[model samples]
Target: MKVAVLALQGAFIEHEQVLQRLGVETVEIRQLKDWQQPIDALILPGGESTVQMRLLKELGLYEPIREAILIGMPVLGTCAGMILLSEGRLGTMDIEVRRNAYGRQLGSFHTVDTVKGIGTDVPMTFIRAPYIERVLSDKVEVLSTVDGHIVAARQGNQLATAFHPELDDGTRLHELFLGMVVGRSDKE
Candidate 1:
């Protein structure tokens, strides 16, 4: 029931707040030691992808996190997080993500859309977001799209979204991630 939120950068606190409101225990992961805790799942929040990756490596957390996800540790990645998990970075989620696909900060906006398994009119807030340019694996399921661009997807225990679900009041996305976490625990 405990989730680790990557606090090295970005909207991590927002994710933690949402998870907390859902009554889930959350731990901020800011260092390699934090990753040692008994977390049932992990959240990679939105931020600058390049900086996040640099910190992950410098802090000696990159490989462990990636390997953990590959081995089925449930993870929810948002914005830059989606980029982090894409083909070239963590390389766990088989998707190619284009960073800041929505141009600059001025391009950020909000809208309501349907996320595949989450019902209709899901509020989505995009801030310097990225989009899945192409899915490299058949196992990856496209969850939602905005203006024909892939915005949300799930691959096994890994869930990724270009928009910040934490920024909105909706719990479907976070709840969906919790479902993945519970599903993982059940299998064990």
Candidate 2:
């Protein structure tokens, strides 16, 4: 299976490395043309959400990608990507996310937390992360929380996390996303 990692900005390379380690083929999505390729899933890496959104629009990729997600494309959004998916009125996951909810770079931190359905004590690295303020729709499933803050959730084919799972050694979150991709593919 092939996954597309948004390479316009952020920790996209890390996500690619993680996918490669899992023996999954990956393609870097840097332009509108990149979206033309066949991809089993998409990874919106952690980065500055505002900038990513602007770039997405300027590159003429915003609508196509959004339409794909609306049609049930499996997407895993991390950190700023979470904000972009939820906050910029994407409405794909039925979530409400607050950008930089943890403050700025000064507020960045690391913690070992339990990611629901992934097991306990997973390493989570937060760099200017955003938390799910509320799940707007009952269809959204809260996946993990840290210090009472909603940090992860999933709805249908879309998964989102406030923490940068790619910044850590554990690949459980990526594996979980792959599971989502595989599950959807099987149904097709």
Candidate 3:
């Protein structure tokens, strides 16, 4: 199956590499035409949320992508991508995210945590990450936590993690998203 990776900024190439290793076809989405390509899922990689937000609008890609996500295009958001998907905000996930909740670069860290359904020994790399402060709706399901803070969650077609799964050696997160994509297609 094919997936779209938002390549306008951040560690997008890292995500693409992970997807490639998983034997998944990927398309880098930097323009409107890129979004028009057929794909089963989308990945919003770790990055500076504010700059990504501004670029999304300035490049005229904000609305279409937002609408696609709202309508259930399966999406996996890491770090700043999670912040972008929070409700009453740029994207459609029903949660409130505090940007850089873990502080700046020096505050960055790494740990291996159990990601609920994803199992233990999962390598998590947090770089200026943002955690979910609260789930704004009952539909939102918490997936993982680290240091008493919510780090991963899912709501409908959306999956978000405050850590950069792509930066680690684990493929569970990417496999999980690909599963979601396949499950969605099968149902259709």
Candidate 4:
């Protein structure tokens, strides 16, 4: 399946590398035009939400992305990307983010914790991650958490994670996303 990684900024290249390792065709998304191409899934890598939001506005992708999510396009957001997927954020996020919820970047580290639906003690890497303070709807399901803070969630075909799954060499999350893509296609 073909997956597109938002390359506006952040660790998008790392996501692309992980996808490539899984033997999936990957594309770097630099413009709204990149979204014109058919893709089975998309990834929004960790980065500064303020900058990413501005870039989205500059590229006219904010609404398109929202619309795509509504239509059931599978999306995976990490760190700052996770902040974007939430219904609301804690502090004055560029586009409404929680901001330094997991402390500073230097405080980033890896952990093996049990998630709600995914599995137990999964290795998760956090770098200045944002914690999910609240879920807006039943359509969203919490997938993982650390110390009772929600770290991963899935709203229909959309998935968001506070940690960098790509950096961990664990393909389970990617595989889960691929499953979502495949399941959606089968239903259609």
Best by TM-score: 1
List residue ranges in candidate 1 displaced over 4 A.
none
**lDDT leader:** 1
Alpha-carbon lDDT of model 3: 0.90
User: What local lDDT score does residue 56 receive in model 4, on the 0 to 100 scale?
Assistant: 84
Task: State the weakest 10-residue window (summed lDDT) of model 1.
Answer: 30-39
TM of each candidate vs. truth: 0.99, 0.98, 0.97, 0.91
Superposition error at 4 for model 4 (Å)? 0.9
Q: Candidate 2 lDDT, tens digit per residue, 46-104?
A: 98888899999999988999999999899999998898789455667788888888899
lDDT of 1 by residue, 1-188 (tens): 99999999899999999999999999999999999978899999999999999999999999999989999999999999999999989999999999999999999999999998899999999999999999998999999999999999999999999999999988999999999899889899
> For residues 139-175, could you state the per-residue lDDT of candidate 3 as single tens digits?
9999999988899999988999999999988899999
Any runs in candidate 2 off by more than 4 Å, and if so which?
none
User: Clashes in candidate 4: how many?
Assistant: 1
The model with the greater TM-score, 2 or 4, is 2
Ranking by TM-score: 1, 2, 3, 4
RMSD of each: 0.6, 0.8, 0.9, 3.2
Clash pairs, candidate 2, are none
Ranking by lDDT: 1, 2, 3, 4
| Residue pairs in collision within model 4 | 93-97
- Tens digits of per-residue lDDT for model 4 on 1-188? 89988899999988888888889999888888888988888888898988888888889888887777667788888888887666542211212236678689787888988765567767899998888877766666778767888888877777788898888867788888888988998988
